[model samples]
Target chain A: MPTVYITAPRDVAPEIARTLVEERLAACVNRLACDSVYRWDGEVLTDEEAVLLAKTTDERYAALRDRVVDLHPSEVPCIERFDESDILDAFGNWRAESVGEG
Target chain B: MPTVYITAPRDVAPEIARTLVEERLAACVNRLACDSVYRWDGEVLTDEEAVLLAKTTDERYAALRDRVVDLHPSEVPCIERFDESDILDAFGNWRAESVGEG
Candidate 1:
C-alpha cells in the first residue's frame, strides 16, 4: 500500500477528499491545515495549503494519482508517494478491502 | 530520509509537535485533524485525533522515535515510518541540514 501526499488549496480540499472516497479510489483521506513555504522565481513565498493524505492499495495507486492530477489546480502539483513500511495489521487489511476491484 | 506518521490526542498534539522541532529531532512537523476508526476491545472506536507528520533524516529517526516514545502519553503510540520515495530536491536538502548534526 502507498499513502499519497497531495497538496492543494484549502477551499477545494474537502471536495477532492470526498470525491476520492466516493469514487473508491481511496480507502480514506485525511486533510490537514498546512502552511507551506517555498522558493518561487528567486523569491521566498508562503501559502496556506491543505495536505491530503490518501490511503490506497498499490493496485489503485496509478489511478488515484491520475485522478488527482486531472483535478488538481496547480500546473505542477505535488503528488508524492510514501511507502508503508509499518502499519497496524488490522488497519492494513481494512484499507486493502476498501479499495480495488470493488 | 523518512516521514514518520504519529497519532496523538488533539490537545497534546501541539506539544508533541513543538518538542520534536525544538529538540531538533524533526526538521518540521505537520498536524492534521484526523477522525480515526478502528476496532478496539472488540468494539469499533471512532476518535477525534491529531495526526502528526514529522520529517527527519535516517540518522535521526531512531533518536526521534525514542524521544516520542518517552514523551508520549499513550502506552502504545502509533509510530509508523513511511519511507520517502519522491520529494522536491531542494526540500530534501533542507531537511538533511535541519536535524542530527547541529
Candidate 2:
C-alpha cells in the first residue's frame, strides 16, 4: 500500500474522502484543515482548504485519481502521490487495515 | 524504504538532504522550493524556504532522525513522516534503488 496527499477545497474534500473510503478506493483519508495561499493565473489566491492525505495501495491510484477528478471542484485537482516508506509503523498499519487485505 | 517530508529553512534543507543521502540514511531527497508561512512563538512568520521530502526505509528512520536532529538548524525542525504508497511506480523504484539493498 502507498500514501498520497490530495488537496482540495474544504467543502469538497469530505465528500471525496467519504466516497473513496466507502468504496475502499482508499485505505483511509486523513483530513488536515489549513489555510492555503497559492498563485493561479498570476494572481495570489488564499483560501480555507482541507488537504486529504489519503492512503491506498498502488493498484488503487488510477481509480482514485479518476474518482477525485470527477468529484473535485477544481478542473485540475492536485492529486499528487508520494512514496509510503516514511510512514510510522502504527499509522502504516492503520492505513493498511483500513483498506483491502494488505 | 519510505518517503519522509522534512521541512527546514532553505539555508539548511540541502545540507540535511545531502547528509542523509550521502550517509545512506535516506534513499533520495526531493527538494521543493517554496515560501512557507507558519505560526511560531505566538507570531506569524514567513520566509523563503526549501522543504526536503526525503525517501528512506522504515528501519532507517531512527538513525535518520538522530542525524537530522544533530544537523538541523531549528530548535524543533519539522521532521514529519508520511506513508509513501501514493508515489508513482517509477519514483518508488528510484527511491528504493537509491537506498540500501531494497
Candidate 3:
C-alpha cells in the first residue's frame, strides 16, 4: 500500500481532499495544517500549508497522483508516495474496501 | 530517510512533537488534526486524533520510536515508518543537518 503525501496551499486543501475521496482514488485523506520550509528559486522560504496524507493502494496510486496534480494549485506540486509494508490488517482491509477492492 | 507517523490525542501531540525535535530525533514534525477509525476490542471506534509526521533518517528511527512510545499516551500507539528513496536532495541535506548528520 502507498500513502501519498501532498502539500497544498491551505485554502485549496479541502477541495482537493474531497475530490480524491469522492473519486475513490483514495480510501481516506488526513489533512494537516503545517508550515513548509524549502528552497525555491534560489531563495529559502517558509509558508503555511496543509498536507494531505491520502491512503490508497498500489493499484490506485497513479490515478490518485494524476487527480491530485489536476486539482492542485501549484504548477509543480509536491506529491510523494510512501509504500508501506507494515500496515495493520484491519486498516488495510478498510482501505481496500473504501477503494472498492474489498 | 524515514517519516514516522504517530497518532495521539490532540492534547498530547504538541509535547510529543517538541520532545522529538528538542532531542534531535527528528528534524521536524508536522502535526495534523484528523479522525481515526479502527477496531479495538472487537468494536469499531472513531476518535479525534492528531498525527505527527516526524522526519528523521534511518539511523535515528529506533531512538525516535522509543522516545515517542515513552512520551505517548496510548499503550500501543500507532508509530509507523515510511522510508523514502525519492527525497529531494536539498530537503535531505536539511534533515541530515537538523539531526546532526551533516
State in Å the error of residue B60, model 2: 28
Flag the better candidate by lDDT, 1 or 3.
1
Docking class of 1: incorrect
Worst 10 residues of 1 chain B by lDDT: B37-46
lDDT of 2 by residue, B79-102 (tens): 877654344444445445555532
- lDDT of the structure predicted as candidate 3: 0.80
> Which regions in candidate 3 have their CA more than 4 angstroms from the true location?
A1-32, A35-48, A52-102
Assess the local accuracy of residue A22 in candidate 3 as a C-alpha lDDT between 0 and 100.
Answer: 90
The numbered model that scores best in TM-score is 1
TM-score of each: 0.61, 0.50, 0.60
Give the best candidate by DockQ: 1
Candidate 1 vs candidate 2: which has greater TM-score?
A: 1
Q: For all candidates, state DockQ relative to the true structure.
A: 0.22, 0.12, 0.14
- Candidate 2 lDDT at B66 equals 85
Rank by TM-score (best first): 1, 3, 2
Model 3, span A1-102: residue lDDT tens: 888888889999999999899989999999888755443443434567899989998788888888887898776676667788698999999998898433
Model 1, which residues run further than 4 Å from truth? A41-43, B1-4, B8-48, B53-79, B83-102
Q: How good is the docking of model 3, as DockQ?
A: 0.14
